[model samples]
Target: MSDPHYLREAEKYESPIPSREHILSFIQKRPKSKRQLFELLSIEDEQKKAFERRLRAMVRDKQLSCNKNGVYRPFSNRGLISGTVIANPKGFGFVSLDKGGKDLRLSSQQMKLVFHGDKVKVRLLNRKLDAEIVQVTQTVKTLVGRLNINQDECYVVVDDRRIKHEIDIVELIEGCADNQVVVVEVLNSPTLEKNASGRITSIIGNYLDEGVEVDSAIHRHEIPAIFGDKALEESAKLPNKVLTKDKKGRVDITHLELVTIDGEDSRDFDDAVYAIPSKNGWKLMVAIADVSHYVKEGSQLDAESLERGNSVYFPHRVVPMLPESISNGLCSLNPELERLCMVCEMEIDSLGSLLEYKFYSAVMLSHARLTYTEVNEMLENKKSKLRKKYKKIENNIDFLYGLYQTLRISRQKRGVMDFDRIESQILFDDQGKIENIVARKRNDAHRLIEECMLMANQAAAKYLQKENEDFLYRVHPKPTPEKVEITRQFLTAIDLRLDGGLEPESSDFAKLLKNASGREDENIIKTVVLRTMKQATYTPNNEGHFGLAFEDYAHFTSPIRRYPDLLVHRAIKRALSNKHRERSNKMVELGAHLSMTERRADDASRDVEQWLKCEYMRDKVGECFNGVISGVAGFGLFVELTEIFVEGLISVRDLKEDYFIYDDVHHQLKGQRGGRIYRLGDLIKVKVASVNLDDRKIEFVPVSK
Candidate 1:
């Protein structure tokens, strides 16, 4: 026999008399109790049960809310706002509003029924910014966590620390062991009385296994690790080499000497450059791989590429946007191989100003594949064996160096701010464990290539804007007044000042950075300025880039790795074909999604790096190292070790001296009794106290000298 509840639900679906829309419309007109609604609609005894079921469904969907007096009304009529909940590690949560305001605070008790990333309607409580969840509109379906089995009972603890609830496993898969990472599919959501339940669908591996830390981050961020069958099939069908027919409309520049310069371990080559002295100044050609020539729009490969947005580069691993067949094989500009490309040819005057430029499809052959180290060595040692060996293209390299110097002068004149921060590179052993961490160095060759790319990107952006083509712009807004004020106060504390009125330009920042160079507090000042600036994003609306001091900017290089570059190529192609295309609203949506994916990749990579660093520091407990104060907060100071480039927190409680007070305006902590000060960029000595692998954190304590 069927249950009465199931029968009633089935009956409601069959009959269309009291539809969801009808009930919503009726309640929206005016608030009414169930009896009033039933009487107003002239419901008979038999229809009463069906009407009640429909109303209940409406309430569950968050279309309506029922008051304690049994009165029903539209949710919007009662000041309820819908938002996505962001859970905190401490069991509380915040609801991020869609309209973009301050996040509404949710108490721990109010967050018990909902999971992280759940969409819910919330109503303001007595507090101005505090809210309580009225109803959940959507729930998370799956999560990645570590499995724990106690006797006959099993549960999975989610990797996201903010989600404080452990999912009770109802049906466990075979061979699942304790402390193993696994993916859980939610079977039932939590109620007022019970916790959420789930089933283990897949086991990743033991938490301590080699490369498992990165794997866990991949799952935690829900990054697509493998391509779909259709996408792979499409990639497999791509040609290994450019066909004769494919070069029909392309200008042949293979006779010109072009070279590719990248890192020693780089496998994918997306750009090649050529330079020569012209009558007026210099003629520069930048050839980028034509990825869109092979991957057509609306295809499976395009779909997958758009979803990935950009390649995520880890220390030794790379999750490429496109498959190797396309990114590294067919589209890569390998040496001595004829490849199709989109070229940006520019004529620059003696002042390094771009006088004129043109874009065209071209076929080119890379004469030599060089590394930054080799190029820098050749430039530094003119008469070296390596320079003599590559003498055929030595003149072109010299010309590039001259052009780079000119462009750098122009860039400085434009007041571009450059931060000289050190980035650490991780080295691994044969067993895939961390061996050491070293600083990655950048030289003139790197800057020369960057200037060339920037010129090409600017040309593309200007050309597209003139053609009135719809495309994405790389926009970076200036810092807000509040942030600027904070920066001003911090600079004053360091005995420096930032001019340029309320809205200072990039050149002003450049001057201040110049003044701070070689000072004891250079790194601290740079960090503060960088923090004050807003993050750059992609948008259809052109707001200009604040960091580079460019009036217009768009990503036009490395289409093999970035989807925005691919879209720029497509837009350029459309404009070349003389097609009058209007901007579609879909492009706006795509810009937002691509920006989100970019941030997602950054967060995942940072998580993996932190985990690996923690692992590297695990064996060095109690070892003392000289470090610099990288950050200061109310809780403690963050120190970055000088030798290993590892960072760890020195908690305030661990000071064990005079009580310290945090000075937010000065970005420092001062002892109330002893008057001891610990400011940013101060040299200090610290000892590693502990490492928590589960939390991906390192703790340190001050070492008395």
Candidate 2:
């Protein structure tokens, strides 16, 4: 059944009266007042109201707009721009321009008609940097939120903190209750006079359910959770084991003592490593799962994998890029099983410099499955029980460790910045509640595997560069002048100095970090220096990576999880086949899309972690703890508690003794009357005031000394 409003809109051209097209044409030809339109159409007194209604509808639909002169003109005539709305939680928003100019700000009143992530066209008002939404081209259709029921009245509060509006629920699904997490499908978009309305589509779980937070985040970010039917069907056709035909043109290295080293909980293994000491250097072989072999270009499986871009990992579960039949079955490099892989064989000198390398398709057997903990134990103590259990392959592990040390020396010599920051790991009880949060320690085994993968990736990138082929290079741009100057001022204020000029090299940042090491404020200084750099992204332009200090770099080791790595695999295969392939025409668009998906995964993971942290802190509201001042703003100080590493804000209003003023240059807050100052890295005691799960925020207040 077609909607009546859509029917009216569709048949607008067939109307006997002045059709919408005719009205737009007339307005575009010459701007006219409402009175002028009425007179020009020669309408009778009885038809005046109908004509006025049509004009109003046209304006509401954004087909036409009214200027300050009280004259109507077609919206397409001139001076209109289209962009995506980025709504703020404060009931205002900014439109990121499609043509790359300053973002135009929209007032709270103007924001009432649109939701976050909507696409709209706007006309700049006479006021500077402000615009009014002329039409909504696209509306947010599905949202993940929590339901709030008041007897017969209900509304869904959106999960995105930036979207301040609540959607009125016109219909409800069975078994849904108040404070339940749900997925809502918008039925009617908001207008200036009324809030948007939706119907609950699916109840994920109760708000406090064990895994509901991650489930909500998955839906909220719109990460592709389920594979399409065609993709799954395609995956089903793949063989369960590698056959002789599959390895026809591949090298057989089944005798090599290669092992897969991963976390204890990891199920899918994508890489296997083997190294041996040579006369002049070491011979390193890095075998990566050949995902490109099973999933061909333009296939349904390939399309779905590209859509996912990369696998999203939560602490409890994983949303894989490919179906389980492929990602965990055929593509995983399991131990003692013959698997297809792409091997990078490199010859490195004693100084850890890559002498040469070659890439080829191969059939390899992983000798054993190893864990980082066991490997670290073996390397640290040769007589350990686990070391004796795996003594048959211990020599190969030692060779890899030696290669890692050499590589570490080379990395240090190259002046690559390595920040030693603490990463937290959550331990869950049998009931799925967090038992504790502890800092994860990275051992030599982790660095060994990392250095091996780095060597393979660098070799692959250099191979493509030598052939002058177009491929996606992982590019990290230099910091801007403004950021560098700000960093310089901050360091100077801390009695330190940055040696490099305006455009400092990565080595300069490395030197500054070395100087700040072991100080009480080391973590704070490292964080600030990291903030002064740009995020690394994928591009075909071949800009060097500044942080890794690599002239040519690409992600070529994780094809089982990352789409760009799959593309790299395909490019390398083409090169091996003596066919120099050109870059895909959609490379730029694909790069941008992949970057967005990466950010989406990061944001969703962060959101879930924050929600879990907030839930964990809910019970300790009145407890006091020592913390460091991590951030300062006009509103308050952000303190990260030392005991649990949780951060909360101490609002300025709670500082009742004096009025606080923010000092931006020095990154501190000062009390006007009390003369007390709180700056970054200052240790203080704070009492937890409140926890708001809806906003994912924790509040704190200073404890009187």
Candidate 3:
């Protein structure tokens, strides 16, 4: 039968035709003439013209071959490929192939055919570095955009900057106003002849709205912020509080002095810790909320969490992976409340070497909920007021710090790469507008919690590796040769060496960071070294973690927020029960999907942060401030201001004093006349010249230093 994906093909085109897949499948048996295909696939007289276009397009894309007799067969060439289009804001894009290889670049002209995140089949050009779109198999159905009214015409400017086309709106919703933000339901994608068209589905108000940025970002990133009916129903069915039945066959640790240390503003507590001096060194118990117990693999909540991949944390809002009923209630380890948890108990030596570890299901009551500031103050001063106020867990905090000191030694010995970059905390005014931006300092208490989590994650990874289960490990591959060489050039230009010839170990990077300590350019040096390494991703293969310097690593903490951690929990539970499941095929797809969702969340969060920062700086035009060069490019320098953590750009054209030449190899700008050089990490003075809220851009001009 010459049938295709009838519903899908019908949705994609005005007139349905036999899909490339279906035609190819039919032709696999034997070559077919046009008349035979028309008769077999039931192509009518009116559809023949449209079907001919598809066939010709397929032949041009190298998906099929047509002989002198007009007979068609599958194309034997390997030039054809399928992948997702990752578009850039500059009107160009690249195809990230399904079978991994170098991404094929598409020119701006070719990009007009498809939107960002659309799945398409492409044909590699003769140069091999570029590709042309053969067909858009899947188009983005909905997009977030701002309504633009140009005289008699109305269109939507997509919030996702990568999608360059403005979708035309033939009909407007009743309340549509000029410059309003809206969600567009895509009707048809753009062709070479015309622009994209859509219908206004959601109205988010003006861009200046205090909370519209978050909503727009959620839609642009396709983040599932609203819970589906099925998911909500499932969540509502869950117990409001941990029931006695939930603790069956679990160890009772209610008497233990377990406490949670987190940011003061945090609501959902995923992990609680208790440490005691043991026979060898110390016994540390890390109790994580048992989210997997409630979010079963086949449940709607599980599907929702898997789709979300992880919690998306914006400045003040959070799109939690699990609903509030679970993430902030039953699965949350609140103080003085009994909660069911999966516990990782570890026995470490005085040198912070893991002697032994065990995992079990447990019911525990947190003795106290302590903030990081309070814990740090209590540890720094034995006679502090906060210490007296939290007297119940004072000794418990001491035990945790002692173990932290030992773990610090272990971290240094293992050559862990530490990138202590400045983190910004964005504040909002009473009216919900951005008030200020400030650096969020990391204290010893923060480090203590991080070390504890690291230890627990390592224990989990070791257990999974030993159990020989098909589980996801947080893997960090070695740096690419191109990035390493660029980093080496940058470091050498500053009279520093990265030590490693081509493939450097984490210890080599640690040495470079240690050498740059206390230098004026320390922050940028750390940033450069950090950029040289590849992004860490989850994989079924245990390729090890480079940043943490661990041979076996998996995300085992914060299961309530991260889907991978929940999966790890399930794998551990299954192993403990001596059950074997054959699903290695699914793990690879799962890892890739989780990685993509994580990236999507990060990009969405970053976009919201940028929008807020731009809003914060909108009124500061003409104000002068000191800034350090954080990023460099052919266009200009990205400068982060001193007191305020906001970033602005100093365009090359604004450098009127000199005709500067950008040296991408060494990441610097050299004056064509005066021999002056500007490099990343260099401190400079600049005045904010302009701020464009629509483009989310800030321009700066150099001020006399």
State which candidate, 2 or 3, has the greater lDDT: 3
Give the higher-lDDT candidate: 1 or 3. Answer: 3
Model 1 lDDT tens row, 1-705: 122354455575664345566666678878888889877767678888877877767765667777545778886646678999999877889999987778988889888888999898887542246677878888888888899999867898888867878899998888999999999998887777988999998888998898777777777787887999999999898889999999999999999889999999899999999999898789999999999899999999999999999998877788899999888999999999999999999998888888999999999999899999999998898887988888888887899998999888889988989886677889999999999999988999999999999999989999999998988988899999899998998888889999987799999999999999998768778888999899998898889989989998999988999999999999999998898589889889989998988998998998888889999999999999999999999999999898888899999999888899999988899999999999888999999999987777899999988
- Root-mean-square deviation per candidate: 9.7, 9.2, 9.8
For candidate 2, give the lDDT of residue 573: 91
User: Candidate 3 residues 1-705, lDDT tens each?
Assistant: 635487889898887888888888878999898889888888999999988888878877777766545777787645468999999988899999998878989999999999998999887643436678888999999998889987879999888778888899977788889889999999998999999999998798887887899999998888999889999999999998889788889999999999999998898999999999999999999999998889999988788889999999999899999889888899899989999999999999999988899999999999998899989889889889987788888889999999999999999999888887778999877888777899999999999999999999999999988888878999999898899899999999887888878888989999889999998888889889888989999899988998989998899999989999998999899888878555597999999999999999999999999988988888899999999999889888999898898888999998878899999977888889998888988899999999987678889998986
The clash count for each model shown is 0, 0, 0
The superposed Cα distance between candidate 1 and the true structure at residue 413, in angstroms, equals 0.7
Tell me the spans in candidate 2 whose CA falls farther than 4 Å from its real position. Answer: 1-77
Which digits, one per residue and each the tens of the lDDT, describe model 2 over residues 409-486? 888888888787766677789999988777878899998999999899999899998887767888899999899998
